[model samples]
Target: MLLPKQMTRVLIVGSRNALKDTIEVLYQLEAAHLIDFSAEEEGFSLGAPLPESSVASQRLLKLRSLEKDMGIDDEDVSGQMETGQIEMDLASTIDGLEAEITGAIESKNKINLRINELEADKAVLQSFQALPLDLELYHDYDSLKVFTGKVRGDPSALVKAAAPQSEVFLSGNGDFAAVFVNTAQADEAQKALVQVGYTEVPAPAGPGSPQKHVAKIDEELEALRSSMKEAVDKLDELKDKHSTFVKAADEHLSIIVEKAETPLRIGTTEYTFAMDAWVPTSEMPKVEKAIAEKLGNRAHLESLEVMSRMEPHGHDEEGEEHAPAKVEEIPVKLENGKTAKKFEFMSGMLSTPKYREIDPTSAMMITLPIFFGLMVGDIGYGIPFMLLGLIGLKKCVSDEWKTISTLLFFGGIWATVFGVFLFGEAYGIHFAEQAHDLSWSSLLGVQLPHELVLGGFEIPLGIYSKLHSVKQILYMSVWIGIAHLFIGFCIGFYNKSIRYGMKHAIIEKISWLMILVGGALLLLFVVDFMILGKDVALTDIRMLVAAVLLVIGIGMAYKGEGSGAILELPGLMGNIISYTRLAAIGMSKAGLALAFNTIAFEVMWGHDFHVLGSNSGDIVMLIAALGIFLVGHLTIFILAIISAGLHSLRLHYVEFFMKFYEGGGVEFKPLKVIRKYTIEKNGVSE
Candidate 1:
C-alpha cells in the first residue's frame, strides 16, 4: 500500500497482580506501541516502577562507571553470553570488577599527578642549570641582599658601577648573573639590574646543585611512568577478561529494567491498572488471542477504534488550525519493500508522510536517479560510478552512504544507456565519424559506423547532441518539468479531495492544472511565432484554446485563493523555466569535457583535432597526453557527482516536491527490546 500502515487504538485493563504477566506478553508480542499515561481521570494515578527497578538501576550505574574506567565500548564487545549464565555470574563478577577497577584507576591517577609535578619541577631546574650555583646559596643572605636572574647581556660591569661594594658572578655564557650587594645599596642595585633587562628567578630551598635535583626528579618521573603503564595494562586485562560478561549483563539487566518500568506508563487505581496502546489493525485478532491465552481471566483486552486515513476538514469555526487536540494521531509506518525502503530516508528527511496522504518515497526513487543520469549522460564517468556505488553498498553501513550508493548505482545504469544510445560518446568524443570532427575513428585511424546494422535494420548510435541541440533539449526539459508538476497537482488534488472535499480540491488544485495546461499550449504557439518564424496569430486555434483555458482557470483560482492566484501566473511561468537548468547543466559539463580533451590531445600530445591539421605523435607526447587525460577526467568525474547529482536533487526538492508534499507526521515506533550481546533462545520473534 502506498498509504501508511493501518493502526488501531487498544485499551488493556486488569487487576494489579496481572500487570507483570501483561507486560511480559506485550514484550513477547512486540506489537504494542504504548502511549504514556496522563493522570487526567479521577481516582487514576500514574503507576510506579516495579519493586526490582531500584536494584537493577543501581547495578546499571555501577556497570556504566566501570565501563568508562575500563574504556569498554560497543566496538570492544566481541562475544555474547546466555541470560542464565549472566544471571548466575553477575553478582560475583561485579564485586570483583569493582575492586580491580577501583585499585587500578586510583593507582593510575596518583602516578599521573606525580608525573605532572615532576615535569613542572624539571622545567624550573632547567633554567637554573645554566648558572653554577648551589640551590641553598641563592637564598638566606642576611648581611648581603642577593639578586639572581637571567639578563639580556653581561650585567657584571653594570652591577659593579651601581654598587661599588657588590660582588657579581656571571655564567660563562654571560646570560645569567648573580649579584651580592650591601643592604644600603640594594635599591640602587635593583634599579641597575632592571636597566640591563634582568628578569628575576627565585631560588628553591633544596641543599644541592640544580643538576643533581633535576636528575633525582628524572629518576622519579621514569619510575612513575613505568607504574602508569603497568596500571593501564592492569585495566586493559580486566576489560578483556570481563568484556563479554559485562556486555551481556548490561543487556540482560536493561531488558529487565525496561519490563519493570512499563508500569510507569500505565494508569493505576487502588486495585486496577489501565494501559493504552496502538496495535496494528491487522494484528488485533492475534493480540486478542494471545492476551486471552496468556492472562486468561486475570486481564481483559478491549479493542477501541480502528483508525482510518479520512481525517476531518481543516480549520473549524474558530479559525484555529487543529480543532481536535485531544485526538491521538495514528502513527505512520510506511509499508515499503526493500528497494523503496532505501529512498525513505530521502523523502523522510523532508517530512514523514501523514497517514491520510500518499508516501512519496516511491515517487522520489523513480525520478531522482533519472534526473541524475540525464545530466551525466556520458559513458566515461558512468561505468566508474556504478563500480563505486557497488563497492560502497558492500562496504558502508550508514544510512547516508546507502542512499548515495543507491543513487549512483541506478543513475549509472541510465548514464551508461544514455551515453551509448543518446550521446554516442565517451569523454566528449564521438564514437563514429562526422564531417570536420574528431572522433574515436579519426584518432585511432580506423573506420567506425554511424549506426548499427542488424538484420537489414538501421539503429542510430546517437540522437540529440548535448552541445549542438540546445533548443531541442531546452524545449524538452521545460515539458519534462510541466509533466512532473502536472503529477504534483494531480497528487495535490487527490490529497485535498480526501482531506477537505471534492469542491475544495477542484477549486485549489484542478484550477492550477488548467492554468498549467493553458501555459503549455501558449508556449507552443509562442515558440512557433518568435523562434521558428511562423505565423501565429491571436485568432489561431491554438491561441484561442490557450486563451479560453487560461481565463477560466484564472477565474476559478481567483474565486478559490483570492488575489494570490492572480499573482501566481508569472510564478508558474518561472517554475516551468526553472527546469531549463537540466539542459543548461548538461551543456556546461560537455563544454568542460571538450576543453579538457582539446588541451590534452591537440595541444599537449600534438595529435590532430581533425578540424585543425594532423600532427605526429611520439613516446613523450603519449605520456603527457595520458597524464593530462587522467588528470582532466578525474576532475570531471568528481564534478559530475556534485553537480549532476545535486542539481537533480534540488530540482526535486524545490520544484517537484513543493507542489504536493507537506510532510510532518509521527513515525511508527513499536515497543520492543533490542538485545546486543545476549540472546534468548526461548523467545520468539514477531
Candidate 2:
C-alpha cells in the first residue's frame, strides 16, 4: 500500500449520564483517535475526570512504591492473577505489604548502618592492637597531652629530646607510637612527630584490651549480618508471593484510570457532552452501528466530511460557513502489509508519513537490503549473518533488535545472491582459479567452473571481481544511484500531485525529474566521447536533447522554487557520487581479505608456492593459518555490519528519501488497552 488509511472526521454527542458508557463503547471498538477539546469554543468547556480516576490513581501509586521498595522487576512476576481476585484482595494486601515491606526495609537499613559503624570502630582498634596498652590509659590525663598514631620511623628519641618529662612507647615494628608529654611541651613533641611523617589515629572510646574490644565488635558484626540476611530473605519472600498480584493490579488500575480520564479530553455542559475524533473510513459503519445498538437514544454519532489531500485555500464557491478540513491533524495510519510492516520501525525512526504522501516503508523494504548486500557481497560471511539474524529474530522481543535482524536476514540473502552471481567469491576468494591470486580451486587441487549449464541454458557463476573490476563497478553504482533517485522523484511527483495539484507537482517534482534524466544522458555522452575516445559533434542528438532538457527543467525549477533550485544542482551531483561508496566499501573489504589470505596461505605454503598443487604444506603451519584466517574474517564480518549497514541506511536516509519524503505527521493511536498478564472474559479479567 502506498498511502495511509483514509480517515474521516467524526463527532459523538451524548447525554452526560451516558458519558462513561460511551467511553467504554469507544474503547471496546478501538477505532477512534480522539481530539482534545478547546475551552475557547462557545458554551463548551473541558470536562473533569470521572469519579474512579482519583481512587484508582492513588492505589496505583502505592502499588508502584511497594514494587520499588521490594526491588521487584518484571522477571520476578511468575504468573498471572485474575482481576476479580486482585480486586478482592487489593486493599487488604496493600496495607499488609506496606507494613511488612517497610519493617523489613527499615530493619535492613538499621543493620547496614550498625555494621558500618562497627567496621569503622574495628579499623581504628586494629591500629591500637599492635601497641601494648589498654584503651583507657591513652586518654584522661589532666596535665599531659597524648599523641597516638602511625609514624614513618621511630619518633621516641625526638619526643624524649623535645620534652624531657615525656614518655614515648613504640610498637615492636616501629610503625606505631604513643607519646605522652607535659601540656607545656606538647607543641614541641608534636613538631618532632610531624618531622617523622606522623598521621594521627585517634583511639576509639572504650575500655579494656584492644584485642578484646575488636573481638567483641567482630562478634556483633556477625550477628548484624545474620539479621540482615533474615531481613533480605523476608523481603524476597514477600516479593515472590505478591509480584504477580502487584503487576496485574497495576495493569487493571491503569486501564481504569486511563478510561476514567477520557472525559478530560471532551467538552461537557451540565446535561450533555460532545467529543471530536477521527475514525478510519472503513470502520465508520461498524462504529455507528455499535453506538446505536448499544447506547440507544442516549447517544448519537455524526459523520463529518472525508479528509482530502488538498490544502485549504479559502471558502468554497457555495460555502455557508463550513469549517476547513484540518489536514495536519488528520492522523496517519500506515497501510503496509505484514511483510512490509517490519520496516515500519525503520521508517518511524525518521518520522511518520503524512496522510497525503506515500508510506516509504514498503519502498525501503525492497532497496535497503539490496544496497547492504551489494556492499557486503560474500557468501562466506552472508550465511553466518543469516544464521545470527534468524536467531536474533526468534529470540529478541524488542522492536530495535527485530528490525536489525530483519535487515541482516534479508540483506544476507541478497549478499549470498550477489556473491554467487555477480562476484563469484567467498571471503574474497574466487571459486574458480585466478590467474594472479589464490583461489579455492588452487588451494584444494580441484577445478571449479565459471558457469553452470542447466537445461541447455548457460548461467554464468562468476562475473565481475570486486578488486579487478573497479571501473565497471563504479559505473554501475552511478547508474544504480540514478535509477534509485528516479524512483524517488516519481514518488515525489505523485506526493505533490495529490497534496497540491498536477501543475504544482510538475513544477516542483517533475522539473527535478527532467534535470536528473538530462544529467544521466549527459553522463552517457561524456563516457562515450572522453573515455571511449568517440568523436562527437557539438550538435549531436544526445547532447542537444540533454541541453534542452536541462535548460527547460532548470527554468521551471527556478520559477517554482527560486534560487534554491540552482543551488541544489551541484548537491544532486554529490548525491549521485555518494552511491559510489557501494563499490568503494566492497573493494576495501576485498583488499583486506586479500591481504589476510595472502599472509595465511604464505605461512602454510611458503613464499614460492603460487602454482596449484606445487607443495605439501605442514599441518601445524596450516592449522595456524586457519586460526589467522578465522580471526581475520571474523573482524571483517563485524566491520561489515557497521560500515556496510550504516552506509546503506545513510544512502536511503540522505539521498533517496530526501528526494521525496517530508515526514512529520502524527501517528494514529486509538484508545485501546494492551493486556499481557491477564485475560478478560465474563465482563471481568482472569
- Compute each candidate's TM-score over C-alphas: 0.93, 0.93
CA shift at 346, candidate 2, in angstroms? 1.5
Q: Where does model 2 exceed 4 Å of error? A: 150-153, 194-206, 313-328, 681-686
Candidate 2, TM-score vs. the true structure?
0.93
Q: In model 1, which regions exceed 4 Å deviation?
A: 314-323, 453-458, 604-607, 611-613, 681-686
Residue 524 accuracy (lDDT) in model 1: 90
| Model 1: lowest-lDDT 10 consecutive positions | 312-321
Q: What tens-digit string does per-residue lDDT give for candidate 1 at 85-197?
A: 77777788898889989998999998999899889878878777877788888777788999888888877788789899898888778777788899899998999999889
Candidate 1 lands at a TM-score of 0.93
Error of 1 at 346 (Å): 0.7
Quote the lDDT for 20 in model 1. 89
